[model samples]
Target: MLILGCMVLIAGCGCLGLWFAYRIRRRPQELRECSMALALLDTEIVWGATPLPEAFGILKERTDVPWQGFFGELKERLSQGESAGIAWKETMIAQNSHFCLKSEDWNVIGDVGKGLGRSDRTEQHKQIELVQRQLMVIKEQAETWSGKQAKMWSYLGFLGGIAGVLILI
Candidate 1:
């Protein structure tokens, strides 16, 4: 019974590690998806010269949750007559919990809104491109760090649990 209990504890610890690792693994994909959404926004801006709300509406359809939610919120805000920049910031703050992004990532995203209605087409394109690049950088960072640490986290959890069981024994 003691041995069985130890094994169960160890398994639980290992599962915790795996869960952490799995969350880490998903971060890169989330950033990549954000990058894609930005790209879609850029396309709408450059080719269609689409208005901010309509561009975000298009993105809301092309993206997944959290992203779709973010864009949808922006569209809703715009429809309500909020300024584009203000809507962007408000939606970002409101939907922040839904993303895996860090504070730095949020700052980068905030920068994307700085030139919304104030900028020329060329400048808007540049801002979108810049944000897209930043997102790609974050995605690369997540992929690199996860590649190194995810297995380590899993192994450490398994080993730490085993050690704990041994100490108890």
Candidate 2:
């Protein structure tokens, strides 16, 4: 029973470690996805000449979770007569907890929200492109950190579990 208990404890610790590593690993990918999604939005607004709410509808169809949900909610809000900036801000706030991005990334995203529906297509595209550039820079940083730390976190988690079990024993 003691050995079994130790095994369970070790497994739990290892899982916790893996979870940390998973979050670290997910950050860059999520940021990349965000950048891509923005590109799509730029195309929709700038070239396709779609309205904000319709652009969001198109975007939600093409995106994955978090972004998909975000765009969908934006569409709904806009359809319900919410203002563009307000809808974007509220949707971002509601969906931020679901993303793996850092504060810097969130701030960049917020910049995009600020320009939505408040300007012409050219200006909106410029804002989105700026945010995309910022997101890429941040994504590069996140990738670098993820590469350096993800494995360390995973190994540390398992090792830390073993250490805990040994200490307890």
Which is the leading candidate under TM-score? 2
TM-score of each: 0.88, 0.96
Q: RMSD per prediction, one decimal?
A: 1.9, 1.0
lDDT of 2 by residue, 69-106 (tens): 99999999999999988998898888889987777778
lDDT of 2 at 169: 86
Off by over 4 Å in 1: none
Estimate, for each residue in 59-91, the C-alpha lDDT of model 1 and write its tens digit. 999999779999999999999999888988998
Stretches off by above 4 angstroms in model 2 are none
**TM-score of structure candidate 2:** 0.96
Which residue pairs does candidate 2 place in steric collision?
none
lDDT (Cα atoms) of all candidates against the true structure: 0.87, 0.90
